[model samples]
Target: MEGETKLFTREELKCRCKRDDAVLIIHNEVYDVTKFLADHPGGEEVLLEKAGQDASEPFEDVSHSSDARALMKKYKIGELVECDRVQTKNSFSPNWNNDQSQEQGKCVIG
Candidate 1:
């Protein structure tokens, strides 16, 4: 359809795991990084290791810089089908302590 977003299943994603054709799932979004393999700063091996699977944890663990994150948009192809989607860190907001009492007396002047 005109405005519909593409969706992919796990099995379909698994079939694309190859040096010539790779796909990745990060934060529920699908990315076809096949063309990027050779140019990746971390090297093709790192991306290949997570091919056809969810790389959200490892991807987030690296804390990719804003530029890296923005570059990923070019590789995005689709999203996982609803049934194959998993909860990702971006799905929720962390509960940070808002109590004023907790902020008291933490700073010291030498």
Candidate 2:
């Protein structure tokens, strides 16, 4: 079972939400970011806020660079079990311009 990936349930994820044991779910993948808290550029607060929950939306909202995305692989511990998995938006290529009409109320200086 050298390459076999472990699976985790939502409950299991919820139990590790503390600052000393933070776990994040992004794109259906589970990551133990406890050790990374101090190194996070956005500050540990950002990660702690979404600990033990599906952070796909927030994670995809920011335009993360290629290097940042690649670095996440280091913390990946497992994937959400099939029953808890959901379709996550593409984090790598977020559709920032998908709906221009949604900004109708915003004042456009340009």
Candidate 3:
């Protein structure tokens, strides 16, 4: 009970991804990699690129060894909560409905 994982939304994580406040989402788990930037084996730029985004794929691609994985535990911050992410539909796009058009007879079909 004392070491329960924390939960954070995507927007909240994005806010902390700047150069000064950096956080990483690797394998759906958030990690405060800010302090590790200077000591990162791959360099700070690599982590910066993945700031505020899901880095599961790229992280797995490298096939980090056990030791590398263990080192990341120290920075463990939280885990992403599974939820129905609602995708906002674009309202700016024009929706052409021939039945509801007020511009009737404006086009010559000859």
Candidate 4:
């Protein structure tokens, strides 16, 4: 922790997408895995799909071994700033809460 890096926004991470500048977000933390692509046990395709986005779910889904978990630290880049998350078109859209469908407390199945 003595030489820990600073926070990085999602947008900032997305900018590093080229083969030579790959970066991934896992569990809200950034990891520059560019150099590790060739060494990745799962190969580069999986990492490419998760590039620039949160890969926590998929990463956990793979059930990486303890050795793989320990290897991740070598690529640690930085943490995501809580207030600087990237926003998609749907992120700002309004959600229906107490609308007519819920007035009668009934559910419709189609």
For each candidate, give its TM-score against the true structure.
Answer: 0.78, 0.77, 0.70, 0.71
For candidate 2, the 10 contiguous residues with the lowest summed lDDT are: 101-110
Candidate 3, residue 10: Cα displacement in angstroms equals 1.6
lDDT of each: 0.79, 0.79, 0.69, 0.72
Error of 3 at 3 (Å): 3.3
RMSD of 3: 15.0
Candidate number with greatest TM-score:
1
Give the alpha carbon lDDT tens digit for every residue of 29-96 in model 2.
99999999999999999999999887777887887889989999999999877766654334333555
The parts of candidate 2 lying over 4 Å away from their true place are: 90-110
| Clash pairs detected, candidate 3 | none
Model 4 clashing residue pairs (backbone): none
lDDT of 4 at 66: 93
Report the number of clashing residue pairs per model.
Answer: 0, 0, 0, 0
Model 4 error, position 36 (Å): 0.4
Clashes of 2: 0
Ranking, lDDT, top scorer first: 1, 2, 4, 3
